[model samples]
Target chain A: MESQIPRSKSQLPIPDYQSSNSATLKVDRVTKRYGSGATEVTAVQEVSLTVAAGEIVLIRGPSGSGKTTLLSMLGALLKPTEGTIRLDGTTLSELAENRLPDIRLRQFGFIFQDFNLLSALTALENVALVAALAGAKGKEARKRAAGLMTDLGLKERLNFLPEKLSGGEKQRVAIARALVNDPAIILADEPTANLDSKIGHEIMRLLRRIAKEQNRSVVIVSHDQRIKDIADRVLWLEDGQFKEMVTMATDPVCGMAVEREKAAAQLELDGVTYYFCSRGCRAEFEAERRGQVVGDRLTLQVGRP
Target chain B: MILVAFRNLFQNKIRLVISVGGVALALLLILALDAVFSGVEQQVTAYIDYSGADVFVSQEGVRNMHMASSALSASVASKVKAVSGVASVTPILYVTNVVVADEERNLAYIIGLPPNAAMGGPWRVVAGERIPSDGEAIIDAGVAEKSGIGLGDEVKILGEEFTVAGLSDGTATLINSVAFISKRDFAKLRGDPGTVSYLLVKVEPGGSPERVAARIEAQVSEVTAQTRPAFAAQERRVIKDMSTDVIAIMNLTGFLIGMAVMALTVYTATLSRRAEYGVLKALGARNGHLYRTVLAQALISVALGFGLGLAFTLLLAAIVPQLGTNLSLLISGASLVKVSLVSLVIAAFSAILPIRQIAGLDPAMVFRGK
Candidate 1:
């Protein structure tokens, strides 16, 4: 049957940011509080950070350090008591709560720590749900979800429910769902907390590889220091403040430091855009091109090796 | 999707069964009362239709045939027969007394007609023979069935002994069980052998009952005449008024209580499944869609309950003679539809609050697990 899947722009994942190239996400002095008066408790206080496109940002904090709160604010899940958040170029703090859902759907893809797949649906069905919610047609959504699950090495388990899938398989299904809508950014809160160390590190490697290969910004809120080496920059959040970060990658296609928000140039190929930190790297990429058409079948299935 | 909603209901079989059972029991109560009311109405109307006399004359204020204490003098019969267009006159002597069958006495009615009266004889006899003399009586088949008495058996009524000579179809009082006897025996039992209770007057051929009834009323000072139907209707109206408040209250309470329970069950179920509702909201199910799903669930519940309740009530009516005569248990086709439609309205109304909650659910909640 002819599929009616939404034809996303080839430049999805690395959308052009007009002229505001310095930041893909910016948090300017954000604060969040619960309760009132005598019972008032500050969850996140005076926190600030920035992430450039194509860079993986690792947020490290203890349970009560308000890591989840910061992630929620960035994802438009919660409102800030004091400060503004900007995604790409739009101010998120000013958006109404009723309209927050639309912003989340259009710009953000989420991966919860618990791998929250609906219990009644299968792996393919779970991934298809996000596409369906984004207004994709039934047959097309299912087709795209099947392609995504097959790429995630879950082809054989596509029809299995959450209870039937193993822990790592469930997380993979959730990740496929997160990427299904082609959102500008993926916000994963403790995405590997429920898996074993081997599977956990495997998941982190997958996230870092996606960031570098596909030029999509990935933000993971976690306290799992074992996977810090995979992040391009690690921001230590203590008592609701960003303490430090380190840059670990220089874009091969550009002679500039890799940052989550400040990519220098973007190129569209096979309906997806690849970001570079400088124009020089983009030229080298063009010179080396074989001129062979980068067809729709660019994403290869990721089976465990 | 509605497919998901339907699957959710089947996911927990025990809860679904229990919920259906509760609805059925509630529906049964309402249906039982409706059937009884229906049965009593048919009995009354049937008796009136078969009585055949065109006009009825009795004491000026007397209402029902069962209230024989209001009997007028035997002279009223002759006065009514003398009216213009009157073709025949039959005195009806009706009296009630306690009669024993197996050491247990029940209130029994005695409808007394003349030995050879064509206007007021038992229309159908199911056993033995009709009352032949002053000391003989024809018992209602229902009365005989309940008392376990038979033809030729002697039953003592109000201190006088009479032989049960026959068994007739129908019962005492359109709403009560009764036996038939000769008019002379009825007077003897009531201790007034000369005074008769009601005068049944047949209009002459080709005469209108209304005109003759009017003429008789104007001529007789101690009695009034009415078309047979009007008199029977008056009798039923008088009896109904005496117990209207009680019956109305019982019916109202039953309906209200059933509605309250149904509403609570549907609302509580919706609240418990709020997260599931959020999933539906996120899937682009509009308010109208949500409303239809809830309405469908309610309609199904009420329909199942109504069917079960109606069947149970009919079975009861068939098995118990007292319920057949007194309680009515008519179960008419239109009445079945009416009661079920009433329940459907109740179910639909009860689902409103829950559907409103579903329609207003925040889609983000589906992601937040709230």
Candidate 2:
């Protein structure tokens, strides 16, 4: 889900928030088919998307809907049977097999649903190993890994093994690993599914902050609907293709999906307006934001329209 | 990749022990069988090796005494004694027969000794006499002990009874035991009054046995002379040629079993951690790295098992003598080299299946659930 895709508030086309930055990852109508003759299985079909720098695209879908296949093709882990996947300007599908590994190492980072930390290595070493794989010196890799872990709030848990760490810490370590190589794009598959709600949101927010601050592209695929608030653009996929996605505005009160014209209450916070599903939610928002920095145009309206 | 391979190999302590034990046991089977053959080779040639002769003159074209007829005219010994480098000559009659004692009998090499012989007598008589007198015998100590015969005991040889006069050492092996009797009695029993089976000659100080042997061949008629080492080597070869096929079959069986054990061990370790290997591949590790991991693991196991097997063989060599039997376990250089080569082959063979498995592995398996 690139920012330049045709997503709008009222079916009216609007400029992308990050149209100024170039696309780091681009997939042009890629199709992946397995087997042949009667046993042909089309796991992914004609999926096209472009992700600009610092853009966070969350692909949400039901199970077995080709979310993983699309993510795999985007990450260059699997070659598409048709069409092309390009990182910056190089088409990954046309490269030699020997060249794909270094591209995967230095160009695209991967975060798995299960964290997938090597059980034998410590948390710090797990992140450092990725840097070393990209040809960083040992001392430099360790230092980089240490800094990433500390920045991710895992300073004291660096020496713990994956089995010894909590679910949240493991995912954070995985995030650090995905970022350790400083790749142009990060492909995360169900990264927050194993985590609880509070920790899951924190991880999503951390991912958003990292993508924005580092100008790195992030594409997350998950079934968890609760993470839509943190995503800049949430694209829906079904049956090996993308449907017209809902540009939803989440109601913080009851965590309901509140579209722009379907809000019961609205509170403008800073430049962006926050829509509430009810007057009680808007009142709670106002009491919570008393004496806080409110937006200049604090539009307080309570109506169904 | 090396670190992961090591962790995978050593992850299960019990399995590691089983793997090491399998290799060690396989190595033991091989080294022990080879060492037994080596000991037999040494024991079969004990008489020739310990006999105090610098040169041996036998019937023409006879190089070894075992299972061969070597009869020279009695005058050949005299002519050999006349050779320039000959210090002394002792002629002995040799025959292969059995010694019997009260329903118990075993094969024996019944040797004939001359009276006051200089070289042709029991070289190591641990008891009464080196050369037997008439109507008396010198018996191997090991054979005597096993047969419950003592000094002064009467044993039947060639259907005649002779009292045991001395007990000798290094004269018995699994194949046969050496028993000594006087040349007069041997000639009487054989009824061949003027024949010598062999002539043992000692060279003077500062003389070459090979040169003396060549001179004796030139001077003596109807006889062949060989230096002591050449003759001893021939005797050992005689034994080796007889047992090579059987020992070779046994060694080959042991080596194959060793390879199978090592292969099974390395393959099991690789299989148990197969997902981790897939993960490594998915992480952009080349197949060369994974192959090296497997090969290194197999070779390490072989090296450890080889060291363990060698220690056990040396311990067997040390403890075998205390059992007080004629069975000796001689760990020779040839046996060590043979086992070392066997180990290298075992390691290489063991790594084959695992490397193939890794080479064909699809990295997509890492994304799939079990």
Interface RMSD of each: 4.5, 1.9
Which lDDT tens digits does candidate 2 get at residues A1-305?
A: 21222222222111113322334788899999999999999988899988888787889887888888888778767899999988777999899988877887777777888888877778998888778777888889899999878878788999998989999899999888877777778788888889998788677766665666567788988888766655666788888899856555656655444545556887776667776668887887787677575653466767674
Using DockQ as the measure, the top candidate is 2
Best candidate (score: lDDT): 2
Best by TM-score: 2
Residue-level lDDT for B199 in candidate 2: 93
Mind giving the per-residue lDDT tens digits that candidate 2 earns over B229-330? Answer: 999899888888998898888888878888988999999988876776676666666777789889888888888889888898889878987898777888
- Deviating ranges (above 4 Å) for candidate 2: A1-23, A117-165, A168-182, A197-215, A246-297, A301-305
How does each model score on TM-score? 0.69, 0.85
RMSD list, candidates in order: 9.1, 6.1
**lDDT tens digits, residue span B1-370, model 1:** 4434454445556655655666666666766766666566556545455667898887887755655456778877777888899999988877667666556466766678887787776778888775547788777766776677888787776677878888888655444556677887777667887788777888999999999989998998877788987877876676666656865676666567667766776787677677756654543344555677677766666666667767777788787564544444567786678677778777878788888888678654544547
lDDT (Cα, tens digit) per residue for candidate 1, span A66-92:
787788788777789999999876899
